[model samples]
Target: MSRRSLLGLGELALLPGGAAAPLNAGPLNGALSDDGDLARIGHRWRALATRPGTAAVRAIAPTATSLWPDLPYPSYTETPARLLAMARTGDPALADPVARGIEHYVRHVYTPGASADGNWWNWRIGIPRRLLEAALLIGPSRADRPLVEAVDHFVHPCHLAAYEGHSTAANRVDLCQVMLLRAVVGADPARAALAASALTPVFPYVSEGDGLYRDGTFIQHSTVPYQGGYGRVLLSGLATLFAVLRGTRWATSDQRVFDLVEKSFAPFMHDGFCMDLVSGRGIGRHPYGDRRRGREVAQAVLLLGESASPAERTRWRGLVRGWGFADLAPEAETVEPAEGHRLMAMSARAVHRRREWVAGLSMASYRIAHYEHGNGENLRGWHTGAGMLYWWARGHREQYSDHFWQSVDPYRLPGTTVSTLRLPDGAGAAWGGECPPARWVGGATDGHFACVGQHLYGLGSTLEAFKSWFFLDDAVLCLGAGIRCADGVPVETIVDNRRTDAALTLGGGWAHLAGHGGYVVDGPLRTLREERGTVRRAYTTLWLDHGTDPDAASYRYLLLPGASPELTRARAADPGWVDVLANTDRGQGVSVASAGLTAVNFWQPGTVGPLTASAPCAVLVRERGDGTATLTVADPRRDLDGLTVTWDRPVAAVVRGHPLLTRARTGRRLTLRWGRLADRGGSSKTVVVRLQSAK
Candidate 1:
């Protein structure tokens, strides 16, 4: 069969409007139903339609002066295509101007510089895809030919070949979309096959420098973990292409892509908000990030749901409903359950969720940075990567909504342990690749519980500390040790720092910062206030002020999100809820008996409770009450080839839900060996072993 014969375009051509019919139906079968979405699309259309020169095509194109020359035409091509789609939906006023705009775009707007710079990849893919949809809606005409020919410039073999090894996943997906659209519109199955073939490489393409890691860390620009920024672009492009290719010969059946969506992308969402840790500098760059809205993830879920089978659609619908987006909620009940705690070891990020609260810990390592100091955004985000933690519950989202970028003290971010040295004005504001030079900067999790540790090094200062966070069911236990700095500045560990109008009270070994939950302080506590613009917000900052300590200093604190004053007082009075099993330069460990979980971060080979390991590792154990315990072990340094774990109790072990072969029982002691740790693809060398008490 010829490549062109596979698409069955002849059948599609005879159906009402030929190649242009699908465009007229609106993108993704009229998925833009939200009032905000419709308004934004309408506004874009109105602006383009009312532009002075859009009503008529130019006789002579303007000379190219600037790289992106303004040619008395709409700079963006997608606007006109979308407007034409809108016009077909009973609004004839948009038709003439849109038709004229498309004419102007093909004649003058698609310039040589734009084509050569490859900046037009986004427009080349998006505009033509939408234009084809518009043509389908408006019916075939002379206008359709020009639009199709213009898109050919993007999807031609020579142009499409350049993006084959593009640095970012987003660019690759955009290229695939262009190829797929050209294949569908041109009725060439060869291009459709090429597009389908392009998508397969991206599914398992784990770039050692950038792209999706097995631990769910998405990196873009080679160095930044951008799950919320460029990662969104990649996911949205895939979702749209999947929707367009559904029921077609080019449709994908790759389970890895679907697994990435459900397992990797889904965990980053909490109540429709992508955690800021993976967002890079997006929060400081745009208002959307500040609002904590995970709109891209929501849109992808909804669009994928539209093309999903009955069972998968139910699961996608349930995930969307839990995000708290009222518009995406389905009328029928959805059976998909909410995700639990996760420690993305490759990303060095931890997400802890309870029934009412969701908290995220953003840490920096030799691999990740505190913040990206580029693109004129996030210039002042110095401490965002120093174990910065953000927790959201009822009424807490609005607390720091407007205060993160320009307001609030950068050194006093919640869950950060830092020196009090003020960052020199405009120190790291310039564009440069700045990553923390630290190792052993990751965590371990058994699905429900996690332990994250970082050997943190201060930027532009000689400060170092061993910081750790233990995420339990109801609370996060934060510990800091091995603190030493010759930088003359006082070192302090900040716990629960946030902007709140709620009154603060400090007494009974506990402090309550209203709108930010409560904290059980293991040391001294203080309140700080900063005024920015018209907002005067107070911050209840709990810290152990180690002033010029030449030796190691340490501190401990328990963060209880959504806790009442009485509960906070009672918890502070009882220390048994959290046990600090170890706090030293070599290791940091904690046990939460209430949750029946114990976590230990062995800075080196060490012992904690009933378990001992032979190398720098992280261990999380959940006592499952039914004569079985779930043990999660990880070598965060990524150096150990093998490690042996010994338990003081008689037990039999299973690895990744399967019984292990390398096990032994001796004198009531159980031992297991995990070998070839660094060879498990790109994932964290972590293994989940379910151990049952041996009779």
Candidate 2:
């Protein structure tokens, strides 16, 4: 075995105990910083300390039924911070109380292994982290020895690299943080070095597991996309570590960690809002909506900028500033536009951004759970990952935040076609345990435009469908085909299940929900208005019923976000605005003439309008308003080594193409060929060609 194999991760070969002196308290405190944002730690210290009934009764009485008197488990951990805050007051009267509280914590409550109940993390990471931070704030104390020893008893040196559990991604970051704090409190340089060195595993991109991916996708719990939950934790932890370890002997210099600011976190956030699609079960938690999560990330970015390079610092600040100011001053000319589209094929998710709005689509595959349910949260998120479409607009800032998840119908989430089979709470699976038997769950995008597709297999239900969303500049063309179910229950395709108080008005075969947007549908549309009040909120729901045991049912619709009712009526009347070329089990395609874009999801060798593929693929052709045209293609199935696409349009020459694009020939028809796609991740490959006038 290699030498690295012997040492294991985050491990070191240390010399005898007399080798070097332990690090002093000053540098560690300086590294942690008592100024800047962290200085706010003591702002409310007096209130927390003086809150008469705040103490944990469980600490005073171990057999107490409630974990704490009035607070929660790990709320006792805040005692150290409260004491430190009180010490900062320099009032002699407070000193005895602070010291006694610290002694009580070290002796009674956190007395090594006493916190073995509940989650392992609370004992090992949560409690120790709070204690050490407060200790640093309070400077040094004679109580440090016992306090640090108590921490070490529960948190072992190699706990980050233990045989199993808590050894990857966010958990690893958390463990490393605890160890670093433990080192500072214990005055041990060896532990600090080991803790910093252990962070290397989290820096590199992982191929098929937890941690960040090359495509800017972050996964936790093996098969769940958790950019909003665990990703925030990873980002926040790294931001603190990067700040705390700067210029120290144990400082991390990995560029990949720095790169994540732009690559992983930035794309999904808009106007200080992170999409619910990547939030996992955290979406079901109270008061933790998209904007709240976005604000947390924005704050973390600002903190991270304190340790980032000057250029990186400026760029991150600009992003945060934009998200902060985007919704403010509506009368001003225009805010910073969220202009682009992102296709995270690795995670089966996509996002499209425009100046007026931002939209996201969530899907599931063999590699990702349909929706995660654990800790008794998100019990009804069975259809969240089955092509749930959500968006944010100018006036609809608090749309989803107005108690939507707790109130909306889980089976009728927007943009999802689901079987109305009744299921129990915590249905489907828990902790991302069950993966939907679907692999064709990705798309092709060219930064500005995208065509996403998903061959969905319903979670814990007998439902299957091929859904596609072609994102245009002003509207999204949504299509679904081959929608079949065998559960003998009604199958419905949700068109717009929105939380809005605006009256729904129908005119000219199009429906518009004031203050939100409008939708143009092809088939019979049903609407329902209801009020849900665990706090009492209103919702507007629209869907198409495919009867019981639907077979090969289909629907096509156009979603115009932030559109006026007049514009909706105009588009509904103008067939030239958007044309549905084909809607069948084998293929689905659309042509948005106004945008000069034609896209298709070919389930097999078939034709959609003038486009034909030799195998299953997603193809998008955009006329760039110039002589040149861009063609993007991908094999979402990831089972093709080669594919040929032919567009029946006269082409002059092949301009440029991807490395895998070996053949781009021009004749009476434009022909493109690609190979070497086996074992690929369904990433998009684009080729540009010079188009001649159509015959």
Candidate 3:
């Protein structure tokens, strides 16, 4: 047997009494400068903190109650591992549940009979995700024979001869395990040397870029975009890397490495939410989830807070709070933080409270809540991976469609999916679904666009075929959806199921997409050459592209499911929208609703002509034609909750000099109500209006 064969995972090492020195207290006070910049900007953060009502007990998942092997792993089970780690450091509070967490992992991580080999389990083995995970947990000295043998087999044709090392991003995960094993086995030089040998070939995967898109920044494999929550995986990779560095002696704290990681994460922080983008028209599915891989980034940022400059701390805090990840909050409703959460909270120990109540509120107006789609495409937010690369973002990105299994980890959640990565000690949401009697799919077409660093960048698209991109923090979002084409089967839809209030404002802060991507574009918008993933060309993926070439198509109705729309008073409406071009698969003319702005060309690339035909569809006419002329189209596929329009600007309309409640205001003009639609009982109530030009 190889020397590494002797070392096994789960082995605990006793620190040499004479050799190891006790680590000292880390930076606990605020950043070095105590710069008031964050304090000032954070004034808003502090004000929003302690947001009330996030704590009201929510209804539980009625059906998911009795589900077993529920979440691949609750992650909460790692409590024992956490307690042991913490107890060794002299922290007493880490005990109670920690033991239970460990026990859970031992019991559930590998359920016998679940796999072909009674002793072996599918813990994502075919995919090799767990091998890397185990490698990260196993240190140099402690190598489980089976685990080492498994790692040996998992490594693809590479220098170290391991599939675990095949993926640069995956290797990062293994990096952590290798160190963990080393620590467990007393960090013997021999084990460290062997582990280092294995890690050698994997370093080339790290690209000079800040971060990767959809995958790691390694230049070789980055060409293919995997979207659908790939960002969360990146987050997991970084988190694992950080833990490995801190836990094992294999790596030293490198400022450059950490800086790059931080800079790579920059794009996620928009306004206050780790915004996928500021705005878009439909439920743009930028599935940057709130948890998953990002949890590690949160932890790393928190740890950096200890030694960070005041400005850095402020920035880090903003990133953490900006992700719109209330679920990760200790007080979140759907999900709660325990030991893993503690790691995140404490890591930010360097974070100083400017105000006792400052909270994180994404300046980006939840974009998905804006436009409605009947399809389930936009709902990837909760289950998908993080914007900065967390698993849930990927899960959500992949969960809604038939391709959802691509995003499934085989181990996660209480049911449906995520059973593959299940770890007894892992922490995850028990219930992740909308409260309703309906769980509908296939209504509208959804798409995603993001600009993470090359390390992780790409857009999630439902167009040709469902595909996604992550790690593109530097790019802009461009997505168009056809809620209902002239001829297409209708679908059941829901727009704002998760949000508390239904905001109908068209233009606001950064677009807040609930489970999809949204965009608010104006000015010199940059154009991106489509970087299609391999799946984009798959016949079954984009069934629409059966034989049509995108370049030759005269009119394309990129289907946008009209599920549900958030009806609010803030969004704008263009009543003057003209019918540009309407192409239907069935060659039938669709009913252009005057209420929701049937269709308008806000911005066309190159020289795509405007809708030449006077639109029976809703149109937006600026008093002087400055804002935009929007033509809206509703979901013929499904009935929308409601359709309301807000002008580009705020207007308090006065008819005969009397200001009224419901009026379309844009750019300082008097907003007389143009049109409105209400879903009283699943049926729409249409409101009509005429522009009297009171001005």
Each model's lDDT: 0.64, 0.75, 0.25
Off by over 4 Å in 1: 1-90, 103-109, 113-159, 162-167, 182-193, 205-207, 288-293, 334-339, 399-403, 420-432, 533-540, 548-551, 649-661, 681-695
Worst 10 residues of 3 by lDDT: 341-350
CA RMSD per model (angstroms): 7.6, 7.7, 20.3
Descending-lDDT candidate ranking: 2, 1, 3
Rank by TM-score (best first): 2, 1, 3
Kindly list the per-residue Cα lDDT of model 3 for residues 1-695, writing each as its tens digit: 11111111001113321112112122111221142221121121112111222222212121222112333343322322232333233222322232233323334433232233321213223222332222222211122333344333433224234433233544333443443342222313444444444444433333222123222121112221211133334344443333333333444233433453343444333222322221111114433342233454454454444333566655555555544443233232321111110000000000001111111111000111211112343333332221112212211322222222233221221111011211232122221111111111111111111111000101111111111111111111112122221112211111111111223223332233333323232221121112222333111111121121121122111111111224211121321222223332111122122322222221111111222211112222222232223222222212333333333333333222212224444344322342222211111112223233335
Compared with the true structure, what per-residue lDDT tens digits does model 2 show for residues 1-695? 11121122112113221111112112123432323222212211111222222333223322222222544334554555555455444344444455455656777667875848766776787777766655654455656777888888988876866523667899898888888767665656777778888888888887687988888999998889988889998998887676556545566757787788778888787765777788999896865478778877876776666667878866776776676643322222333545899898889989898988889899999998988988789999999888999888887667677588888888889999999989899886588988988878887888898989899898878899999999988899999999999998899999988887788999767999888988998888999998875877788899999999988999989999999999999989987787889888788888877677889888879899989999988999998788888889988888898999999888898888788987877978998889877566788888888888765
Residue 202, candidate 3: C-alpha displacement in angstroms: 5.9
Residue range 1-695, candidate 1, lDDT tens digits: 11121123323424442222221223321222232222222222222222222233322223332112342334455354444445445334444445555555556655323454434444556566666545433333455557667777655655445434452477778777666555544545677677766776567757366677776778776667777877877777776666555444556745555666666777777655676777776776654463344766766666555445667766776776666554555453643435477777667777777778888888877767667765567766778788888888776665446545656677788888787887864455343257777868877776677888999988777889999988877778888888889988788778767766577778777987665567888767766664543345555556668787445888888888988888888899998878898999888988777677888888878897777988888877776766566667777777777778776665555445323225444445666677655544313333444455455
What ranges in model 3 sit over 4 Å off? 1-167, 183-187, 194-263, 269-296, 304-488, 491-606, 609-695
Score residue 555 of candidate 2 by CA lDDT.
91
In angstroms, give how far residue 458 of model 3 lies from its true place.
19
* Comparison by lDDT, 2 against 3, better one: 2
lDDT of 2: 0.75
